[model samples]
Target: MTAVVEKIHRGRKFDQVLQGARTVFLRDGYERASVDDIAREAGVSKATLYAYFPDKRLLFLEIALTECTRQTEQAAAEVEDDRPAREVLLEAAQKIAEFKLSDFGLQMYRIAVSEAEKFPQIGRAFYETGPQAGCGLLCNYLRQAVDRGELVIEDLDLAANQFVELCKAGLFNERLLGVDRKTTAKAIEKTAKAAVEMFMARYGAKVDA
Candidate 1:
């Protein structure tokens, strides 16, 4: 009982540190965010912060991975195996596009991109945890769809990447460039539909009634 309580306490402390790191990283970016700031934000001592996260980069990676896992799980949960390929693909695209354009997503992306040149590991971590994980989930869904005769994907991996890129369409670039950031549901739906249409044009299998 004592051991379990201690374990739970440690878990809570870990989470507290992560929450603090996330706030600091978001506000100051990776380059400017300091361990001291994160410790203060977390309401923990510097020693406690260091005990949980040895370095700032590892702390940042943990935060990124946690967020990525959350987003990936949310997207994956929305995929219905019994649904038609078009519907599933459209839903996935809409979720991806919406998340990419969201404020939190945009901020996280900016931090990753800004630090990528100086810290390549950060970029790699972001890619592996974010896009790569997302692509992998989509690829699995596509493979299942193919087996179910819903899609005819020759290269599941490539198709997954292309489908996601299609979903981004004009939204991601525009948001990244500061040209447009106010994405509406209508726009997201339209992008999803267009992506599904184009993707189905190439890989969708014809079904008999």
Candidate 2:
């Protein structure tokens, strides 16, 4: 009988490549960074890197997708407590803002936005995997809250998308410009409170006269 060759699942190897590519992209920016540098940093040969990703653009897209998915998942998982629906949304906004303003997170945002014309897929994937995913998760949570008689929302999905847009208003615009600005923890907290207040005033279970 002929011996069979064992399949080598290469998840860990791909992760190393992603980290190396992220480092090179950050250190040199997108235009100046070369695949050779990434391969060296990843401790893999050029051929191995090619085996994992067809080209530099694809590798970068993978990085964006991976990072976006991580942040979105973290935000969805961390949204918590028995607070009112308004307050819960505010806390969720803060967590999302904090994740969005992170170092690697910011870098991912820059590459996605700046080179979006060059790599439209990166920006599209970032939206689809990150904000869209978060919106869907928030919608599910809101549906649960509605079932429990918390928020008086009639349309959970629309409400979720609007909530994300409101949070992004204070968080996304600044980060996109690559300015010398950062979102402080206090600022994020305040922004979160504002999101809840604004949203609740429009659609809360209770409305003050």
Candidate 3:
């Protein structure tokens, strides 16, 4: 019982540290964020921060993973079994598109791209946790749609990637390059609808009369 209580306390402290680290990293970016700042933000001593996270890279990786996993899960949860494939896909796409355009997402993306050459692991981690995870979720949903005769996709993986890529068309690059940051909800909906329409045209199963 004592050990369990101690473990709970440790976990709480770890979460506290992570929350603090997240604030500093997002506010300062990966290159500018410092351990001292993280410690101050977390309201913990440098020793305590180091105790939870061995170094800045590992800490940043954890933060990135948390954000990516959260977004992936949120998108996946939008896929309902009873909803029409087009509706489900469009809804999921809108959510994902919005997330990709969010300030946090943009900052993390910039951090990953900027640090990719110096810290390839960070880039890999972000890809695995963010885009790859999102793709996997969509693939799983597509397979289910195929099973239900809603889609005629022979290559689930390719279709999944294509659908998401279609939804992100024009928006991701524009936002990433700072050419367009104020993308409205209507634009996102239009993009998602277009993506769904294109995907349905290619792979949607024809209904029997």
lDDT of 1 by residue, 95-205 (tens): 889888876687778767887888776787788889999999999999999998888888889999999889989988888888985788898899989999999999988
lDDT of 3 by residue, 29-137 (tens): 7778899999999999988887767777667666777888887877667668788888888888888788888777877777677777886766777888888999999
Candidate 1 global lDDT = 0.81
Query: Candidate 1 or 2, higher TM-score?
Result: 1
Candidate 2 per-residue lDDT over residues 17-45, each given as its tens digit? 88999899868866688999999999998
What's the lDDT for residue 20 in model 3? 94
**Maximum-TM-score candidate:** 3
Specify the poorest-scoring 10-residue window by lDDT in model 1. 1-10
lDDT of 3: 0.81
lDDT for 160 in candidate 2 is 87
TM-score for candidate 1: 0.79
Q: Cα lDDT of all candidates, in order?
A: 0.81, 0.72, 0.81
Instruction: Provide TM-scores for the models.
Output: 0.79, 0.75, 0.82
Off by over 4 Å in 2: 1-12, 23-34, 81-83, 113-124, 207-209
Which ten residues in a row are the worst by lDDT in model 3? Answer: 1-10
